[model samples]
Target: MKRREAIKNLMLFTGGTILFSAGLLAGCNSPAGRTFISKQDIYFLDEIGETIIPTTARCGGAKAAKIGLYMKMMVNKCITNEERLIFLEGLKKIEDAAIEKYRVEFLSMNSDQKKELFLNIQLEAEKYKKDNKSKPSAPVHYFQLLKDLIVKGYFTSEIGATEARRYEAIPTRYIGCINYKKGDRVWATS
Candidate 1:
């Protein structure tokens, strides 16, 4: 091939590659690629998720795990539109309930206060569940949704897998059902 022709072909290939990569990155970062959560909602979610799973010295918390981002992505990409709306509205209601009950934001409360508030919410949610007794209930069952999201988001994060649960990524081989004596820390696996 002529040197000039080769140079032109190389430039074309480089340009195409750059464009392809840019497209891929855009798709990966798009809201459509994740949960369709708004930025304002994410701010509240971050605060709430951080409270549910606080960052510790040994293990990264929900914020470090980007649980809010994960929740948003899951809601947007996986959940139904109705569910997404309900969950979003549920979060707002939770905040409002906190303000009405304790005169403070849920995130602003101390650990004990947060726990107490959540306990009451949980009781109320349970009562609602018992009264309703229906499957695929509104995601606004408040405490149930919060608990589910917290557990789901935290455990799915890399920090949760590695530090919180002490999971190893490589070496996929596993031994089934090891014997353990009483009073040992339980293994962390789904």
Candidate 2:
């Protein structure tokens, strides 16, 4: 459990490997009474994920990679029951926050509104971390989780691999330091 917790925190901060959670591979073998992410949640999650990694001049973002579907698999399979609930509650929190801010649901928000909402959640998470600085095992806010998963899922997805980052199956000889370009995509060695 400590290892899993550590991995979760690590991903939350640094965005670890793709959605290969043990639960994902474990199939429907989670302990009985476990609640899974519902279909309705996926739509909001996609919106959030897209907000986290919006398409830009470079390439399409998490939505192009279908990150919400990947997140669903990760949460249902790999995430612990506790974290799973946190994730779902996080969705509800997003909706509630949206309503409070715009008098509309999160899904009803325009792109700019969504971005602003995400920024507010990020601020809240930072405040949460500061207030719980002494607690080593303090859990992160769900927005943090959403951001982490967006990065992981995006970078590992097909579009992320071939477009967002440079991916070559077979490489020529390693050319040691070429002149670096400012807008160059990072190499996907994995």
Candidate 3:
């Protein structure tokens, strides 16, 4: 009887452990959960994103709210495997080009230098498209990918929703559209 009781308790413990482990794995793979992004990559992304959408005192900054993590999550969940790889490669190429052309890392480049580099890359992508008039455009371009990631990250963040759009998670039951005057604040629902 003692041996039987010990075995039963062990089985229950094993079952509980398995369930806990499964939950932990599921959390890691969850769409809402943060994705894995390198520290250097996140820093670069944050700097770029902040430049695109400057954060004021009222609005939170991209890095403060983990917009880079959101971007990574979106890329992981929404983008195809090929596109995902291409987007990551494009980011690396942007850094490589900055270093090669200006002798400085992308994040290390001055605002004007960064802007010029981005514009040059954009022009090159346009020329590439024109050159390949007969062929379908490439799956992704470096400039476009960077812009898309920055915009997507910014708009989806709390600051974007709350400050940029003035979104409110919980709004009152009654909303009077006609009563609202020009320049009046608009409330948004998620």
Which of the predicted structures, 1 or 3, would earn the higher lDDT when compared with the native? 1
lDDT (C-alpha, whole model) for all candidates: 0.74, 0.81, 0.71
Report the C-alpha lDDT of model 2 over 1-190, residue by residue, as the tens digit: 6999998898876543444454464444434323677677777778888888888777887888888899999988887766776776787788899999999988889999998888888999999988989998987678778788778888889888888988987897898886769988888766
Which window of ten consecutive residues has the lowest lDDT sum in model 3?
A: 30-39
Predicted candidate 1 versus true structure: per-residue lDDT over 1-190, tens digit per residue: 9999999999999999999987687556534443247766776777777777888878888888887788878877787665665676677678888899889987777777766777787788898888787756534575676678878888877787777765655657787886887644345565
- For each candidate in turn, the TM-score is 0.68, 0.77, 0.63
Name the candidate that leads on lDDT.
2
Show pairs that collide, candidate 3.
none
lDDT winner between candidates 1 and 2? 2
Q: Assess candidate 2 and give its TM-score to the true structure.
A: 0.77
Cα lDDT tens digits for candidate 3, 118-183: 778879888876777777855656567767777767766676777766675766676555476775
